[model samples]
Target: MLFELMRKREGVYNEDRKERTENRPIEEATVPEYLVFPLAMHIGAPAEPTVEKGDKVKVGTLIAEKAGFISANVHSSISGEVIDISDQPTIKGIAPCITIKNDYKDLEEPPLYSEDEELSVDQMIEIIEKAGVVGMGGATFPTSVKLSPPAEKTIDTLIINGAECEPYSTADHRLMVDHAKELIDGVRILVDILSVGTVHIALESNTHDSVEEMKKILDKVDHINIVELETIYPQGSEKNLIKKLTDREVPAGGLPVDVHTVVVSVATTLAIYEAIRSRRPTVKRITTITGEPIQEPKNLLVRVGTPINHLIEECQGFRSKPGKVIHGGPMMGIPIKSGRIPVTKGTSVITFLEKEEAVRSERTPCIQCAECLNVCPVSLQPILISQAYENGDIEEAERLGAMDCIDCGNCSYICPSKIPLLDNIRSAKKEIRARQEEQ
Candidate 1:
């Protein structure tokens, strides 16, 4: 029933993902002199600090433990003493963080789970939860919650999302190229845990190298297959990805689980393998630091809590004074006003754009050119949503599927007038959700 469907849509093809880390090997960043573990790396409630200032810790030591079932644990990426536990610069602005000054010993903490024994579904869930795995694709949803779908949902398909669809981002591409075995192993574990019928390793056609690397392992498994997707923006969205791979339309305001499917980022899959086997927490991630402003753009195996300046230094500082430093891809990335912002589990790309590429042009009125609609991956009328939103018509925007806006930034990127359609839609979505909550 599954075949390659080349039905193109409202997505733009911009090759801004080149000239940097996509082709370079991932390098391990030197242990930063200091680390700052944000208590709120994942979604839901932030973790509570378990260690006070001045408490010596080792690599993998639990510093800020999960506060609730939906939260993720925060661990020390290096051996150090807690210098402070207070508000610090993070991707999401100033959030409480546990600051540790590295002792350089790189000491360790014991593994959370032993590999000598086989783990059942429940055991796997427990280990994954404790290991602090989350949606590394920037969603940062607790991975454990995802692995344990509701009893009512009969999940049948598992998709390993290797679609690094965003321009100027290639961390996942590099991961797929360098760590195919570990990625596949993670797929196997998820299949076993979820008891899914079939698994698909979906990669965009642009990343032929990654596709070739993964194709080598596809033959070893019967239920698992390689799905080469057309190079398109936001195809990595679970709904879009599922439709391209399986032709299943995820219901409005519903999750992929509603369609008996789950789509996890490939980086997250690799984390699963390492978390279960090596007993490592979600302490590090492969980040693509690129853009014309960077002197030596390359990918780095960055430890969580490393400062943005650490990467700037690793890249030999900026080529020219960067106009913007965004955390993640330019399209959907949250802007970091300062490089002091520490990297989190969700931090994927540290883009340093020159003023020419970074500065926003003066916004003109929407021309109804339908360019946004033409490139919208979700088929929603972005201008309509933005109009309703700007006019403060919350109900109208809600009716226009504002809540369904994936924040892909395609609408904003494609606007002829440089209208901030995505931002307005996002504002509308927040209001819509608030209205829903009030009910």
Candidate 2:
């Protein structure tokens, strides 16, 4: 089954690459004039604002301080003047932002540490948390917390996810190609922190070039292994990858750590390398700006607080006003009503879909074909849960296994009748959570 899945993925990837090469656009004429930095981009308690309106801030300067265990700090992306500190439109919708007017001076602070100081495991973890590094792969979970697992949970493996499973997102691919050494170094750092058994770098079979590049770097180290994965949807998922490589199923409602494993994305590892080596927090990320409506598509090293509109402008603006703008990949990404939202750590791609592609026909009655059941990675009956939610039967939905759904959108993507099985199932799950909270 896995072999067939891998063969199909290789075909899809080749087709996608050919199409991208044919449709790729030229460089845009204009660069961005300003970047609106949002103060509350990460999860958990919002960072405390350190700069007020009209304050002059330099690039890499801390603009907000971490407020809690789950939160990360915010930094200035450019050397500029703080024009305003007020609610502004962002990619996540309108939120409070620190609007900075660029001076284009390009001023930056000195490095946080000298090259002579080879940091120990304890020192690296402290620097990572202080620098506010999070999972840049999309989850935005605090890196510090992930490094500190309980004593009872023995971490035996560290998996580096280079799957790049989503279509039209090439940030991870480009990183793996260009910075394989840094990624391997970051994996070493993680392994040292967890005192793990071995490190496995998992790349999709479609990205054979990247896998080879990573293998060359890992050959120098003794503990690292490069594992090729089947090119299936959600192959990059922590649970799925854990199961595929280690044959250890993360029990339902549990985490990969429960199976004595840890998964980190390639981008996240690169960020760790930067945080410890350069003593820099995660103020910027590599983002892929692409789609049919985009004038040009290229992987960009974008600042965290940079607005989506700014990125589009950098790409020479859209060819036409897209029917819809998605913040990440089409399958799991959320639809953005406006492009003015600021990019966060979890923002991997800004995709513009044309009118024809964005249109979804009205949902029809399910035919009980059980197709959703067959494709589900978690083996949940999406139809039953969705139907229960549509009828307002919350308890019935829970009993039918609404909570087991990973919300990967595979069911909706594969449905023949265009029924929004994932949407309805998600709604049911939300209600179940609310009910549990009320109790």
Candidate 3:
């Protein structure tokens, strides 16, 4: 009964430019001589290092343990000696990082569970938690916590997000096309964990190859079906995807679990399968290294803790001097000062922008065109929130629903005056949150 409406909603279509790497087969990146593992890669408390400098670790060895219930464990991607543990630069600022020198010995830890071992719901959750799977679509929320919702919140529908809607990112697309059966089986694992009968794998209409491949593998699977979403920016966002497909509007400042649904990314789903079915931790992921400046754009299956510079080199280095290097897609990616930043579980795309594309236009006063409001997926008034924040009126901003902003950056992109509306709103939200915690 879901998706029958397909009601036209408010969204913007940007230049997807998926052709750069959607058709390119995924290339496995070479192991670097050294790797950097930041403890704060995922959301919530930073994991504490379980291994210290000079300590030996093998692949899949627990290098860092989850510090709290909200955090995730960190595993080694290569067998090596812990060279150092210190605060290192990351996509986010400096954080505690464990650096390792690769021995290339490929020593791996033993499996946590056997395939034939039938596991209960708690065992499956333990497998996911131990494997350190997070929302690989970039949210980086611990997957174990997401799957374990409060009992009062009855989850009836499960949405597997396959919509690679962001521009120039095809890691998820490549995963679906190359490993459709694995993705499907991964969904089945989630279905059993959540005990949900209805499931939908949402993909964008442009990714026909992924859709077709998934369809071929999921043939005759009555419990799980495919839903093609319009090719729109932020279509893969959990809240937006849930609303568009199920017609269930997650309340302001609420999560998908609050609305009787749970959303998992395609990458995270595959990680689930590997953690349970293949006996692996989330040490590697497929990342897109593409942009006009890249000499040879490609989708690379890279290991966690690999340097960004290594990925750039794998793409044949930049053809020209890049004006900007973003850690994710251009739309919502965080711009980094250097390529020394190591790849984390959430690193989906490393986009390089040419000079002309990276230049920032002068910011002018807003002309009151209301363009930002027109494109906000959550229907928040960014301009008003920004104004309230500028005026030191955090109360007004809070009342105007500043916390509801998804930080999708659509307001900044759509602003006629280049007002940086999203930045102001983000700061406001942070301040508001800080003040709330203080109280």
C-alpha RMSD of each candidate structure in angstroms: 3.8, 4.0, 3.9
Q: Between candidates 2 and 3, name the one with more favorable lDDT.
A: 3
> How would you order the candidates by lDDT, starting with the best?
3, 1, 2
Error of 1 at 40 (Å): 0.9
Model 3 vs truth, CA RMSD:
3.9
**Which pairs in model 1 have colliding backbones?**
10-375, 17-168
Most lDDT-accurate candidate: 3
lDDT of 1 at 93: 77
For model 2, the superposed segments whose C-alpha errors exceed 4 Å read 1-31, 113-118, 395-404, 429-439
Task: Report, for every candidate in turn, its global Cα lDDT versus the true structure.
Answer: 0.84, 0.76, 0.89
Residue 399 in model 1: shift from native, Å? Answer: 2.6
lDDT of 1 by residue, 32-77 (tens): 8988889999998899999998899998988888888789988888
Judge candidate 2 at residue 393 and give its lDDT. 94
Error at 127, model 2, angstroms: 1.2
Q: Where is model 3 poorest over a 10-residue stretch in terms of lDDT? A: 1-10
Residue 166 in candidate 1 has what lDDT?
Answer: 69
Q: What lDDT does candidate 1 reach at residue 294? A: 86
lDDT tens readout by residue for model 2, 1-439: 0011222211222124213522232222232567877666776677788998889988787888888888877878778888888888765456777888878886886665666888887788888887778888888788888887888998999998888777667778778877788888888778778888778888877777777777787756457888888767777778778887899988877888899998899888988988886778787788888888888777778877777888887777888778888888777788888667878777877777888778887767778877777777777788888889989999999988888776677778766687888889888988898899799
What is the C-alpha lDDT profile of model 3 across 337-402, one tens digit per residue?
877799999998998888888887789998998778888889889999999999999999999999
